[model samples]
Target: MTALPLTALPTARPDGCPFDPPRELAALRAGHPVSRMTYPDGHEGWLVTGYGPVRAVLADPRFSSRYELMHFPIPGGPEGTLPPAPVGDMTGIDAPEHTRYRRLLAGRFTARRMRLLTERVEEITAEHLEAMAHGGTETDLVTAFAQPVPALVICELLGVPFADRETFQRHVHTLMSLDVSPEDRVAAVTGMHRYMLDLVCTKRAAPTDDLLGDLTASDLTDEELAGLGGFLLGAGLDTTANMLAHGTFALLTHPEQLAALRADPDLAESAAEELMRYLSVAHTMVRVALEDVELDGRTIKAGETVTLSVEAANRDPERFADPDTLDIRRKATGQLGFGHGIHQCLGAQLARVEMCVALPALVRRFPALRLAVPAAEVPLRTGMNVYGVHRLPVALA
Candidate 1:
């Protein structure tokens, strides 16, 4: 009922904030629906915190996801210098263009296509758990389990060389880690673009039947190719890695959930959903308004940024009863973990399938997977856009 400045919203969480972001949204739904706030880039935008309002913002045609593609208004800065465009094909395009490229991406991530990758995912999970087993008792699960498996799987899918994983992973670490400085962010983005461009050239020369090669066959120009490859690298590498790491951490800490998942492998499917809801890794969804829009009686101006707290939406009390409690058997049909609308995650199916396969396999293979150190003592990576456990020290009992 009362209007609040977005600056009045809480930002500092030294103990580490999970990606479950809608704390402000919950406050908004309870009190303030449309709140004004400054974005990380210092631009003023409206933060939509309620479920209906957020969903309307996502589905409405007046909102544009292509703010990254064009010189759009930033709230505070002098006409924002369009940061160098993302060197990959993804959320930066509008309907016809986005739809065109999405068709190409849809082919590789279909349920049928994902089924083919299942065995490989299981093998990779088993291999990582085995390697962790061989290493002396305590191993950082982020390094030992979470990071490598998805990196290997995604690399295999895109035909990126395994030897190049460390190289690309460094660029990825710099890009996703909260620790990187502003200057370092640009450098990492540029470096990642360069890595992807070189990989594209190699794929051009000796075409393999991987996702990269498939994209080259499309009508995309060289610039678009870079965008496509860069998008995949950024989206594929970190998101899956976060899911794997954070999901594992969530399960390992919840003994009853872990035991239930171990007892019935079918629980893996539901567990994956619960974990995605629990972690809500992608954090927030940013959209620019193409026209002035009225949301919950508050008008958002054209060309202004509107961020939907997908993390909060997923945990909305209206949507999920007892939203904070992780329930493996919980029906998770409408959760916004991968978002909703036409721009929903293209790789959601693959990511979910990977989790269903990877999580159960890791626990079944090790049977005694428990944290090697106290949960409180574990070091979490700070300042990251993508939330994940940095180090999950676990022992094979």
Candidate 2:
């Protein structure tokens, strides 16, 4: 058997198709589902690109999600050994440690809770739509509609004051931005943590009707609550915001899909799912092997980092029919848009509610919505952790 060459991680999306995963990643998935990876730090690891392998790795407990354990894939990403993830950041921990935080917060985001928020999400969606309509024909949809809807929803859920939202949003943008210097990134994160810490302090003094308030009843300390609030805030804001922005961009570019979605408003739910699958905003994740694991007839030795390309997995031909094409009606079941296993997104249901309500509302409200700028001129977040458009200028006729 020919040895599969060691491939570098692909960070660039192919020109003219910003919604699609990098062509290099697609080819890698097709040729070798599990291949050798050479991290920029010169560490040898494995890259799992296929749907099956990516899902398998995510499900296996032997794979560690610790920040201090896994090798960073991107060039100039934190080099050398890193510190352990702070309390309440579930993404950086494994197993029992993760379980504690997940258990404490899971109830807050349960199906019932998310359903209760449905009315609020609808109201929020409508409010944003109304604002966009009033803003005139030519406006950046990202700011006018996409970003605010989710940001406001998350703010309400976390009990953040409406007055602090602009500052909070600014901090989030800085932290998530890829072009910012390390010092600026640190400062942004520090600012957010400080804000969250203050909020946690207030919640401790007097609990309210929000997620943070609900958690204050638990035995968790003030610091832990602050960390958890920050984690949830960042997660809830960036992922769904990008999904709304990029998904709208995808629909606008593919008029047929947008038209079908607009015509059959009942298709909103499925359309949201298809859009999630088609434009996976949270594109990649990393896990480290804690034990020797046999995968696809190859052994991934313990301590080796594995990069799961969620974008590639979602687009795997074997997983979904006509995977590359955006079909609002396609039953996009088993997609990794929210990831898999114990680490699956806790806010998945909330995100779904937001998208199902927001997208359809925008389309129905503005039947003649179209891009103000040329498709090529629409700026994309090619460098951010979440894939999305930097700004979507649209004319809501």
Candidate with best lDDT = 2
Error of 2 at 98 (Å): 1.0
Question: Model 2 over residues 1-397: C-alpha lDDT tens digits?
Answer: 3436664688888888888898889888888888899887888898888999999988999998998997778776666545578667889998787898888888888989898999999998898888778877788988888888998999898888867878878887886766677788778777888889998998889989988898898888888888888888888888998899888989999999899988898998899899989998889999998989999878999999899999999999999988999999999989998999999999999999999999988888999989998999998887787889889999888
Model 2 bad stretches (over 4 Å)? none
Which candidate leads in TM-score? 2
Q: For candidate 1, lDDT tens digit of each residue in 185-299?
A: 6787778777777887877887888888877887777667866776776677788887887787777888898899999999988888888886777766678888888888888
lDDT of each: 0.74, 0.87
Q: Give me the displacement of residue 286 in model 1, in angstroms.
A: 1.2
Q: Which 10-residue window of candidate 1 scores lowest in summed lDDT?
A: 69-78
Residue 54 alpha-carbon offset, candidate 2, angstroms: 0.3
